[model samples]
Target chain A: MSVGYVSVQWNRHKRIYDACVAGGIVLYLGVFFAAGKALYTGRNAISGEILAMRALATCAFLMLNVILCIGPLARLDRRFLPLLYNRRHLGVATFLVALAHAAIAIGFYHGFGNVNPFVALLTSNTNFTSLSAFPYQTLGLFALLILFLMAATSHDFWLKNLGAPAWKRLHMLVYIAYGLLVMHVALGILQTQRSPWLASLVGVGVVIVATLHLIAGQRERRHDERGSQLSPRAGEEWVDVGAVDDIADQRGSTVTVGAGERIALFRYNGCVSATTNVCAHQGGPLGEGKIIDGCITCPWHGWQYRPADGRSPPPFAEKIHTYRVRVVGRRIQVDPTPLPPGTAVEPARVEEVQSA
Target chain B: MPGLILLGASIYATVGTLFGAGFVLRGVERVDPAALGAPWTFRILILPGVIALWPLMAWRWWCAPRTRGAA
Candidate 1:
């Protein structure tokens, strides 16, 4: 197997992605229209209709948060990566529905009459005098503002313009929005002490979901750190394998050569290559994914990298740290020094193995 | 409950129209509100405004394909 023999293509599924976004928009608009009608009618009390409307709004927000989280989490698990790749539309749709929720809350409950809608929203039901006069509406307003920013910049154009680091930092505001929303519901709706059971249920649901994410994220971070430490140090000589056939195709076989780092060997064509098993995208075990047409596609997000160079294809354009390799006798050898991206190396030539 | 249901239905309808327009802009099939028994004024007039620029948006997306070597 020769390293130069393999080439990978990186592309997205635009059709399905577009369809998912379109579907989400349809659902969002439907909810927005429903909320609009309620606002126009000037009904403020938490009737069944209003409650139902609020519930729908809550569901939409929850879904949007999930979409937001999926992008990062998918790096850890390819199965989950699809959720991230197509999550923008979901976020935008959620924002639109949330806007409707806010509009109804403001228009029907705090109609612009004697007091400004903003003032009324913050001032309504001051029975809980002990709490800060910092109206619950302020929290909701802030959360809505964050959501607005997130939705506005959900497009790739904004991402490209802002740059990934800046865009990612801006998007992190979702956590702040999430916190504000929790407080908004607690201080405003929950404090009214009406529908305690329903409020408690919502509270519990949010806590459980948040806790699950926190725990999973922490565990993944720890695993990534451990994998990073295990990576080969620079300038170490690789051990040799007898032949390329010694490595499995599209699968990783753990191998340790004398006085060198342990590496995952992959055979594409007749050539043998090595990389740390942990995926750079999110610490997924690279050894688990199959070789497809000369590239190793991450099982999580379909992020494809050439086995020879560990360079992700276009559109993603990320290169993982790669080790050097050599073949001596029937065994394979590797160098611990990680070659920078676009560096050229000698190709491996081995006889192709017959399928079992 | 019925009152609430009616309110919910109405709100859903307005939101649906806006959402539908967004989808239409994305190039999905346009939803016919009349089929859902909505008022013609809402289905035809208000809804179209929400989606007035959608056709152009759809055209843009269709024109610039993101995936390489796509038909």
Candidate 2:
């Protein structure tokens, strides 16, 4: 876990995983370019360069869609976690393919046109005011730049330097990039191509991405609702999370306190401790992870924090808000107001029940 | 001037790729040893992209934690 500085440590699995991706890309491009040539033979006046460019563009766009889906897909099903681990490769490959498409497009459309291709790429399209005639090339370029930035910073090294929260916020810009790409394709190629099938495909892609995000949000909302519904054993300030017996060893029972922030009540050894359920790294649910080596480990990235103080161990400093907790008999009571992150607090011990 | 810039960029990429081959062989394998195995031909597939952006990777490599990976 400590080797964060080295090049991606390649193992047999990553080797095979990357090989499959390469093979898939080649197969997709081969089949797509051949199909385009065959389908448009004689009927359309499209050339090889244009056809190849379109094939790569379509392939890259499809990959982007799949890459975006992997996040929500993994959240909905643990089975998809393997795909999530190597997702950065897919993103980098998409950018490379998209770069090829851009290269060919510029060569054919803008090359030898009395102006420098680089300059032409900008000044050639200035009809941004009109929706139909909007400079879609500019949008595509904007999206590509975002993709480039994301690919550049995809490594853990960048993640550690940027800090996970900031890194996550930076990567979230992809949603904006996706929106720009959708408009670029709809206004640019779809206009010239004039196919209902193409428009339907774009519409379907948008719907799928939107639907997956909505469903994931709703699932989290339901979990929050259930956590808030449990009643307190004492005053309004201290909520009864559950009987200490109900909390699994090393894991926590989440409870929503004031302002609806969820708190994870963990039982480690004979004691109980609580922290913000939202992990500092990508907001992962910390209540789900087991304690490893006496520290609560984040399931998403294996980041550890002391349950009592909610602070990560040395060399990696991350903190989460902790709550004051105490046990009354077998029932666990937690104070709603969370201490600032990294504040030390005593853990509540689970009372051993005596024989009748 | 544009042609010269493109030529310079290509040259820079070539050097990065040359350096990246060893980095990928030595250090890259440690970044996520669990996921990747010993370098193979297929791993070279990522070389162009990796080298093209090697400056950032180099910087990250320098900035990353200095601890030796666990056995």
Candidate 3:
């Protein structure tokens, strides 16, 4: 959205969102540290640093769970959309907490070793084969690395440079990171601690995350497979996009052609043109966007493109795959063959030839 | 940087095919023919994570009846 790079395009909403996140972290640590201490009083004495690390670890894990849940929750209900807007913020916080956890663990567990601490971490943790005695620190380290990559590249600059597909692919490592963290906790603590409450909490988090993803994925698959194919196909085929009236003025409708990228057919100014549903910026759904000022504005980032040529207006040279569309009777048919990135084509106008 | 990413993507695409035929049959869109047919790089670049996290993407794709801000 920004023409130039700024550290962060912070707004009142972002400020409030980050504040709540900070407050939540503080509150959770305060409560958990106090409660954990009281509960474990009769057992072997636990040091404050270790307890603090554990608290941060748990918080980061919880925060990640919340972050992952937001995507699915938003899809299930519109109310969760606000959380999605600031998800990257939540991700950065999670990384900080995770980093803190690793720092404390490093200084405590590996700091005293004569062989460089980093070297000792790998050398000391030799039990990689055993399930019960696995080196959970290694798992944690891998998870932290993934988190670091995601957090570091969270900015729009990285997104723009890397391109949407690449950026999304990189960030998708979060799920792998999640899986690793779950193992980090389960094998690391549950194997020895045998704390039913902690086990239950981790179990709950996994169940919630896994269940929501499944439900959401199933819903999406059902929808795409429901009636027709929308995206373009191999060897070029004509697909029914839907009725002309189905698309409102300055609006686009998506129709699945078969198995490929989705195509968006836009109706504007008594004419219709079709383009790839995928937006160049962040792969936002173009079909979901609206035409304003005679340009299609992407819903995700508001990147505007001319309806006639599928090209973003001046100063922004983004282009999308445009399709040839024609109207037959009342039904609209789209040629799924995508033109070059920015090919200009005459729009198929919905003209009325009235007998005078 | 993109070239390096492409190498990584190739590795991912290979693994995706070796272990993802069932996944593709199971409806993994990242490695579909449409995605892989052209340069094959797009599928390679996108399939790694798509195969890794198809559930979330699928949900994101179709969970909503109408996309927000749609006219």
The best candidate by lDDT is 2
DockQ for all models, in order? Answer: 0.02, 0.07, 0.02
Per-prediction CA RMSD (Å): 12.7, 6.8, 13.4
Give per-residue CA lDDT, model 2, range A1-356, as digits (tens). 33224467576767887998899999999998788877887767578998898888888889889988988887788677667657778888988888899888888889978887866877777776888778788788889878887887776655654577878888898898899989988887655876688878988998999899899889878877777676555546788777898988778667775446888889988899989888876677688677999998766556689998998887667789998999998888888787999899999877666679
Chain B TM, every candidate: 0.38, 0.67, 0.33
Clashes per candidate (backbone, < 3 Å): 30, 10, 6
Instruction: Give lDDT tens digits, candidate 3, residues A1-356.
Output: 53444456678888999999999999999998998788777666677998998899999999999999998887676577678777888998999999999999988988986755556666676778989888888889889989987876676645654567888999999999999999999997756685688888999999999999999888767767853436435565666768888888889877667666678888888888889988887776688677999998876546789988999898767898898888877678788778998998788888644579
Higher-scoring candidate on lDDT, 1 or 2: 2
DockQ of model 2 vs. true complex: 0.07
- In TM-score terms, candidate 3 sits at 0.71
Output candidate 2 Cα RMSD. Answer: 6.8
Native-structure RMSD, model 3: 13.4
lDDT (10s digit) by residue, model 1, range A3-41: 111111114574576576667656655675566566656
* Pick by TM-score: 1 or 2, better one: 2
Instruction: List residue ranges in candidate 1 displaced over 4 A.
Output: A1-53, A68-78, A114-116, A119-129, A132-134, A225-248, A251-267, A272-290, A298-305, A310-322, A326-336, A347-356, B1-71
Task: State the iRMSD of every prediction, in order shown.
Answer: 20.7, 6.8, 13.8
Between candidates 2 and 3, which one is better according to lDDT?
2
